[model samples]
Target: MNVLIITAHPEADSFNSYLAAKAARVFEKQGSVVNSVNLYSENFEPVEGKIFYPDRQDSVRFDALREQRHHWEKKILPDDVSRHIQLLINSDLLLLHFPFWWFGMPAILKGWMDRVFVYGGIYDSRQRHENGVMKGKRALLSVTAGAPENACGYNGRHGDMRLMLWSPIHALHYIGYSMLEPYLIHGVRGGLDGIAKKEQQKLLDEKVEDFENRLTNIHEWPIIPFNREDDFNEDKTLKPEAPEYSPFVRHDPDGWKKS
Candidate 1:
């Protein structure tokens, strides 16, 4: 199996980076071909601009989608973008590692998605969701958060993690990846703050074990809930009768029925 690990932590010794390296080793031990992309080390350019697209269809007006498509069709995509795409194309499983910054991914990682997942090449109007080019590939998010586990839970101090991650999760699903249940290591900052240092270390160790287990048994991991093509109507709204895949689509206070 081919596994691509993309890490977006700025600090080399950060918990997320440690976990990413650990994941690589675990996957390698399982006899999988592991390839890692450290965004910080790469000094990846996160912004999409005209400078990256010299050969544009319309030089005056820069439409990112059109330019991306044009460059892809002309086989002149930026070297970095093209290389990232090639890695995704060749991987069976994609592991995304990053600390949850402001309840979302780091700018560099977000930029990776923006540039690497080309608008017309990997996905188009017709080639999204179930028909996405990456449909058969699997993606797993290994996230680190400063908040305590309870704080990120439903009705906890922090908002529900599921809801916070919905956009990115849906984006991954939209791009055709079968997403595995995210691996979350909570209370990360607590460790650094000297809050229950011994206990936090134990928890981190346990999380590492869990991550190793997940990697060793990657094929058996359950996919996260995502609305399928058939679940939506022609207008792209949920069918009134279809099961609600997420809380976002629900209207009633009772919310989504477990499917």
Candidate 2:
């Protein structure tokens, strides 16, 4: 198995970086090829400029932009988004490690997604049918947050972590990948004392083992909810093991629609 690890922490010494390294090592030890990409370290540009224009369907201009896009996607820059996409294409498992910034991923990681997951790559509504290009791949999120679990609940202070993490989860699902339950290390700033760090490392080690076990037995694990089963006409036949539904859905026969 090939695993891609995308690390979004700006600081080299951050706990998020540590977990990413640990994940890479564990995956390597398990005999999986590991590819590590650090967004901030690569100085990746997150903006999509005039490449997306309103009334410009000219082939010449389009081709020019496409060439530029190809360069950005293919050239190995310190932070090229294409390199990560290539890794994603070749890998079986994707691990995203980041320090939660304001209840979401860092801007650099978001930028990487914006530039890399382009129209013809991860998403293309016109060409995408039932199974997307990324079908059958798996993703795991390992986030370090400054808030406690109690602060990250629905009625609690921080709101639901799922709410904060829905974008990437939905993006991956839309492209036909399965998602593993995220492993979160909450209160990173508050929970990193001597003993706490040791406990956290132990817990992370156990979770790493669990991650490996689940990969080895992926068919036995529960299927990810809210995938594009409708395209396969399996909506009626399939039932979600988890009660969670997609927040992006606009309508539902039941009263579960998000208002």
Candidate 3:
């Protein structure tokens, strides 16, 4: 198995980094070829703009999609973007590690997605969703958050994690990856004072082992449910005949959508 592990954390000695390293060891032990990258360390640019396109369709007015497609067809995409896209194409599984900051991924990683998942190169209207180029590949997100697990649950103080993480899941799904159940480690920033020190250490060890064991049995894990292209109508609404999965896209026969 080929694995691509990406961690988006600024701190080199962060728990996310530790977990990423552990993930590498696990994959290596299982004889899987691993390609690891750190977004912050790479100095990855997060904003998408005209700089990527040296030769634009219309120099006066910039169109991101147009330039992306143009550069892609001309085979002049930025080296970093091309390389990352190639990694996605070559790998069978993707292991994403990051801290849940401001209720979503850090801007740097989000920018990485913006650049790497080029509009014209990675997905087009016909090639997206079920028909994406990465149709058979798998992706798993391991998120670490400072909030306690209880506070992050449905109707909790931190809001429902499921809803919060839906965007990333759908993004990967849109790109044709079969997403696995996310591995969420809550209370990552538990107090560092004396009384909590030993417990934190124990929890850290346990989580590392858990992450490894989960990957060891990765094949047995079920993929997250998503409606296929056929499941939607010409209007892009879910067909009544299809089984509804996400609240994001559901069949509302009465026209009054349920929240």
Each model's RMSD to truth, in Å? 2.3, 5.7, 1.9
lDDT of each: 0.87, 0.69, 0.88
Worst 10-residue lDDT window for candidate 1 reads: 250-259
> Cα lDDT of model 2 overall?
0.69
Looking at model 2, the pairs that clash are 42-78, 42-79, 151-158
TM-score of each: 0.94, 0.73, 0.95
Give the per-residue Cα lDDT of candidate 3 at 30.
96
Q: Which residue runs does candidate 3 get wrong by more than 4 Å?
A: 253-259
Tell me which residue pairs clash in candidate 1: none
Leading candidate by lDDT: 3
Write model 3 residue lDDT over 168-224, tens digit each, in one string: 888998988999989999878845878687777788789888888988999987789
Candidate 2, residues 15-75, lDDT tens digits: the string is 7898788778776877889899887887767776544433344545554345444444455
Which model, 1 or 3, shows the larger TM-score?
3
Cα displacement (angstroms), candidate 3, residue 141, comes to 0.4
